[model samples]
Target: MTQTEKYIWLLNTIHRSRGRGLSLKEISDKWRDYMAKEKPLDRATFNRWKAAIELQFKVDIKCNKSGGYRYYIANPEDIEDDKVSKWLLDSVSMGTTLMGNLDIKDRILLEQIPSGLVHLAPIVAAMKSNHRLQITYRGFGSYFSSTFPISPLCVKLYKNRWYVVGQCFYREKWQEMIYGLDRIEEARVLDETFKYPEDFNAENFFEGTLGVSLYEKVKIETIRIRVEYPHAHYVKTLPIHPSQKLIVDENGEYAEFDITVRPTEEFFMEMLRGGALIEVLSPDYVVEQMKGWVNDLYNVYNRK
Candidate 1:
C-alpha cells in the first residue's frame, strides 16, 4: 500500500474502534494482513504516521493509558459529521476499490453525467475572487440564449448535474437564480467583483428542499409519506431528505416518514419512485396534488 493509503487506513481503523480503542499490535497485525505483507507495521513508522495524520487532517489520535494503552480518534464525530471530510474518505475508498479491480474495469458500469464539468473551474475561480461572471445561457425549453452578468453566490450539484446560484439583475431588480452548468454555452470570469453576502449560507438555501428547482412562491410544508415495507427498508437506510423522520414503522408491513420540505416537482418524482409501495398521506392539498398525479398517470396509460 502507498504511504498515504496507510495513513487513511489507520485513521479509519482508529475511528471504527470508538468504544474500545485498538492496541498497537492489533493495528499492526490488521495492516500487515490487509496488505498481504510479510513484515508487520513497525512502531516508529506508526508513530510518525500518527503525527503526520494529526498535522495534515487536524485529527487527534489519543491513547487511553488506563485502558491498556489503546489508541482512538479524539472527537471522532467531528470527521463523521464534516461533509468535506466524509466526501474525501468516501471518494478515496471508491478509488481504492476501483484501482484494485482494473482487470475488470470493462465490466463495471457507471452512470453518465452531463458534460458541463469544463465550466466548473472558471465558475469556482469567480466565486473565490468575488468576481462577476458573464455567461451565455440557454434554458431547456427556450429557443433563444441570453448573455448576462451574474455575481457568483454558490455552486451546487444535483442529479449528476452542476448548477450555479448567482445574483443577477432580473426584471429591474436583483434576485438569486440557479442555472445548470450544462445550460451554460459560454462563461467567462469578469474583472469586476461584487461583495458576497456575509450572512448567506449556500447550504441553508438548498436545505429542506430536494433537487435544484427553486420557487419563490412555494410554501415549505410538512410532507408525510406512507412507504410500505421492502421499499420502506430502502427509504429507512437512505432517507429522501435530511429532515426525514420515522413517524411510524410497522414491522413487515409499512413505514411512515415525516419530511419537512418545499414540495417541488423533483420532490414529487421521489415520492413516485417506489410506485405502489409509497403513498402521500398528509395536508389535504398535498394529498390532492398527489391524487391528481395518480389520475393523470392512470388516464395516460389506460385511455378509454
Candidate 2:
C-alpha cells in the first residue's frame, strides 16, 4: 500500500474497532502486511498520520490517553451520516478489500460502467485548472458529432454511467448542460482558464431533480405513487426520494408515497422501473403520462 492508502487502511482499521479502541501495537500488527516498506510504524509517524487523517478526511481518531492509549474514531455515528466522508471511507474500504481478494477476482461478478471513460482524466485536469475542455461529443439520436468548448465544472456518476455538468455554448445560446462521459468522443484541456462560478453550487444543480436528465423547462411538482404489497417494502427500505412519506399505509396490502421532483423523462423512467407494481396516484398529467406508457407497452406486448 502507498502512503495515502496506508492512512486509509489505518482509518478503516480503527473505524472497525469503534466501541473498543485499538492499541498502537494492535494497529501496527494489523497493518504490517499492508506496509510498502518493512519500517515499523513509530509514534512520531503514527501521530503525524493521525493529524493528517483528521485534516484530510475530517475524521477524528481520538486516543484514550488516560486509559490503554487505544485509538478510535470519535463520534463514529457522524461518519455514517456524513455523505462525502462516509463515501470516501467506504470507497477506500472497498479498494482495500478488492486488493486483498484479488485471487478471488473470478468469483466476484461486478457490473461495469461502459463507454466514454477515456476523457475523465483530461476533463478533471481541465476542471482543476478552471480551463475549458474542447470536447467532440455525439449525443443520442444524432447521426453527426459536434465539437464545443465547455467550462469544466463537476462530474457525477449515476446508474453506472458518468456525467459531466458544465456551462457550454449549444444550439444557439450559452447554457449549462449535462453530457454523458460516454458521449464524449474526444476531450482536450485548453490553455485559456475560465472563472469558476462562486455562486453556482454543484450539488444544488441536481437538487429537486432525479437522475441526470437536465431539462430547461422542468415542471417541479409533488408526485404521489401507489406501491402494492412486497414492493412497498422495497420503497420503505430504499425510499424513492427524501420527500417520500408514508401518507397512506393500509393493512400492508399497499402504501402511498409522495416525492416532490421534476416529472422529467428520467423521473417517469424511475416510476416505470416498478412495472405494474407501482402506479402514479396523483396529478392527472403524470397519471395520464404513465397510462400512455402502459398503453404503448400493452400494444407492444399484447399480441393476439
On TM-score, the candidate that comes out on top is: 2
Off by over 4 Å in 1: 1-10, 17-56, 64-70
Residue 44 Cα positional deviation in candidate 1, in Å, after optimal superposition: 7.3
Q: In candidate 1, what are the lDDT values of residues 1-304, reduced to their tens digit?
A: 5777767778887887886999999999987776664488788989999998898777899999999989998878878888767666666666666766778999999898898789999999999999999999999999999999999899987878999999999999988999999999999999998999988899888877788887647788999999998889999998888899999989899999999988878877887778899999998898998888888888999986
Give the root-mean-square deviation of each candidate in angstroms. Answer: 3.3, 2.8
Clashes of each: 0, 0
Runs off by more than 4 Å, candidate 2: 33-42, 75-78, 246-252
Ten-residue segment with the worst summed lDDT in candidate 2?
31-40
| RMSD over all Cα atoms, model 2 | 2.8
TM-score of each: 0.83, 0.87
Candidate 2 residue 272 Cα shift, in angstroms, is 1.8
